[model samples]
Structure formats: structure tokens, C-alpha cells
Target: MLIKNYRTQFTEELTSIFDEKEIESFFYIILEAFHELKRVDLVLNPNLELDTIQLLQWETVLSQLKEQKPIQYILGETEFFGLPFYVNENTLIPRPETEELVEWIIEDLKIKKFKDLKILDIGTGSGCIAITLAKNLPNASVFAIDVSEKALVTAKKNAELNEVKVTFIEKNILETEDLNQQFDIIVSNPPYVRNLEKQEIHKNVLEYEPHLALFVEDNDALLFYRKITELATKNLSKNGQLYFEINQYLGKEMVELLEKYNFENIELKKDIYGNDRMIRCVLKS
Candidate 1:
């Protein structure tokens, strides 16, 4: 069948669930992934056709999109920090804001010219943070910790996929007392979403994403931050930095929490959307 005709059918089936532009984008994404065709290809060769097997592949993705499944998960892969990553239900899809967090770290460290720093990434779901850092800072040693074994498996695969060496450990951060070793930088984008914020989440996320990686109790939304900060105090080297992708609504509270731990140079940063989304501080010498 003609690819253009299939696109019309795909758009009609998902129009109620997604906007026209989104549906079109999904069509092109799937076209490239499954058929090696791009939007320009469709324009240049309007008579492009899909074989029987390719049509089945497109149909499956179309049905999944109609159910509001995220396109990344439907493809079982995603790009983060300009690197390819394998993603599944076991791991949370890396977000653009988290990429911003990674960029902030890279920019700061690049200025410092730390030739050989040790970095630890807590709750490293898909090893996005740790692997990206290792890939960019070739001289740095990177370690990642995740509580879920399945998540660690995916993270390990991502580390290999990105051709970065990251030591991944499976341990619950909230239950640990000590890191046993100091790190030059400690970072995390942990579960910070409050239960009260569930209503604000879209159906695709609420229904398809991993809740274990996305949420914390409403009454204790800062649980991960508090615990990670406490660990950073003991585990970070003197003058080392601690960074967090935080709950946007709790920036002030985050500063207070970090200040209480005697960290210095605390900074709360806003994402592109102007939400207070990340924080960084220094361990006092």
C-alpha cells in the first residue's frame, strides 16, 4: 500500500487522542524507523509503497499510539544527551530537563578542567547521567546506583550501548548509611513527583511510565533529596559538588535543605520552561 495512504489512515485513527502535528510527527518517526523513509522522501517520491511486513509494523505502532503509549517506549529506544539509549517499562524515559541537568554539570566541570574526577549518579535509571558523563569526560570514573535490578540491567545495557564504562550497583539509597568512598561529584534525578501532582501528569505517563521512578509520597516529596543530601555530606570530597534535578515546586525548600547540611554556594536553576527544576551546591571544606 502507498505510504501516503497509510499515513492518512494513521492520522485519522489517532486524531482524537493526539493533535494533527503530533500524529504527523509519529508517522514520520515510525516511517524512518521501520521503512527508512523521511518526510522529504514522502514529498519527493509520493508513490512510495510499504510491503506486507512493513505495513504490519506500521499498523502495530499506529495501534500503540492510539492507546496513548509514548513513541519512545513504542520504539523501545530514545536519545538523551545526543546519545542513543535503550528504554523499556523498567526504566523512566530520560527527559529534556534532565538533559539540561547533564549539560549544567558538563559546563561547570569543563570550566574547572578536572582531569580525573570521580562521579556518582544515584538512582541512575538507565545510566543516562553516568554514561553521558563518562562519555564526555573520558578521564573521569563514573559509578551509578539503582534500587531495581531490572533497571540496573537496562542501565548496564545502556552503558555498553553508549560505549562508556560505568560501574552500576543495585542498592536502595534510602536504606544506605554510607557510600564508603568519596566522589568529586554526586548527582541524582530521583523520584520527586508528589502524589498530589498525579493529576497534573498526562495519561501516557501516568499509565505507561514506571511509578517507582516517578513518584514520592505527597507528605514526603523531598525524601530522596533529604537522603541524598545527607549521603553527599559524608560521601562528597571537600569542595565537591552535589547536584539534583528537583521538584519544581520545592526550590526554596531545597535550598533550605541543602543549607541545613552546611553546603555552600547553593544555586537553584530554572529549566527552559522557567520552572525551578534543578539545584546545585558545594560541600564545605
Candidate 2:
């Protein structure tokens, strides 16, 4: 069948499940992933045909998409901070808000002129934040930890895929007593979504993404943050800074949480949507 014909049918079928813009994006993203075809290629070659094998592949993806599966997981890869990452059920697909957290850290490093700094990423799903930081901040020693062995495996694979050296460790942040070594920076985009908030999450996310990485108990919404903060007090070097990509609705509580630990320069910054989504704290020497 001609590619354009399949594209038209694909859009019409998915319009009910997803909006027009998202359906269009899924169409082209699949084309690029499966056939090295871009939007321009489709425009230039309007009559391009899809062979039987290719059609079968796309049919499978279409079935999954109809079931509310996320396109990122269906594709088994995603882009973050302009770098490619491998993702799956084992890892949460990197979110744009988390990308913003990475940017804040990178910008801070550029301003400080810091080098050879030791950095740790807590619960580093897919190793997106840790790997990106390692790639961008060449002089920084990056390490990542996660409780899920399956997730760590994916994260390790991502580190190698991105050609960044990050030490991947399998450890539960909540159960850990301490990080034996000091780090110039410690950052976590940990589980901050409360169980009650699941209704607020998209069906694609709630159904396809790993809940271990996405959720927290409503009674203890800051459990991971509190644990990481405690660990940072012992693990953070003099004048070290900590960063968090927090739950948007809990910004005020996050401020109070950091202040309880005496984290100085506690700044709550909004993401592109102006939701309070990122926080930075420093411990002075």
C-alpha cells in the first residue's frame, strides 16, 4: 500500500484514542524508527509504498496504541536532552519536566566552573538524567542507583548506548542507611506521585509505565525525598548542592521539607508550564 494511504487510515483510526496532533506525531515517529522516513520524505515521495513485512510491523504497533500503550515504550526508545535513550516497561520514559531539571544542573555547573565533581542520581530510571549529565559535564563522575534490578539493567544499557561512564548500582533508596562516599552533587527525580494522584495521571502513563517509579503513598508523599535528603547530609561534600525534579503540586511542602534539613539557597523553579517542578538546595562548608 502507498505510505500516504496507510497514514491517512492510521490517523482516522487513532483520532478517537488520541488527539489529531498526537496521532500525527506517532505516525511520523514510527515512520522514522522503522523506515528512516521523515516527514519531508513522505512529502517528497507521496506514493512511497510499504512492503508486507513493514505493514505487519506497523499493524502490531497500531494494535498496541489502540490499547493506550505509550508510543515511547512501543518504540523501545526515546530522546532526552537531545540524546537517545533506550526505554521499556522497566523504566519510566524520560519526561520533559525531568529534562528541565537536568538543564538547571547543567547551567549551574557552567556558572560554577566546577570540574571533576562527583555526582549521584537517585532512582535513575533509564539513566536519563545521570547519562545526560555525564555526557554534557565531561569532567563530572556520574553514578546512579535504583532498587529494581530490571530497571538497573536498562539504565546500564542506556549508559553504554550514550557512551557515558556512569556507575549503576542496585539499591533501594528508602532502605539505604548512607552513601559511603561524598558527592559534589546529588539529584533525584524519585517517586513523588501519590497513589491518590493516579487518577490525575494519563491512562497511557498509569497503564504502561512502572508504578514503582511513579508512585508514593499519600500519607508519605515525600518518603523518597526525605530519605535522599538524609543520605545527602552525610554523602554531600562541603558546599555541595542537591537537585530534585519534584511533584508539581507539592512545591510548598517541598520547600518546608528542605528547610527542615537546613538546605540553604533552597530555590523552587517552575518547568516550562510554570508548575513548581524543580528544586535546588545547597549545603555550605
Q: What local distance difference test score does each model get?
A: 0.92, 0.92
8-93: candidate 1 lDDT, tens digit per residue: 88888898899888887888888788867788888999998889988988888888887889999999998998999999999999
lDDT score for residue 56 of model 2? 97
Extract clashing residue pairs from model 2: none
TM-score of each: 0.98, 0.98
* Model 2 lDDT, full chain set: 0.92
* lDDT, residue 109, candidate 1: 94
C-alpha lDDT of residue 156 in model 2: 88
* Residues forming the 10-long window of minimal summed lDDT in candidate 1: 108-117
Clashes of 1: 0
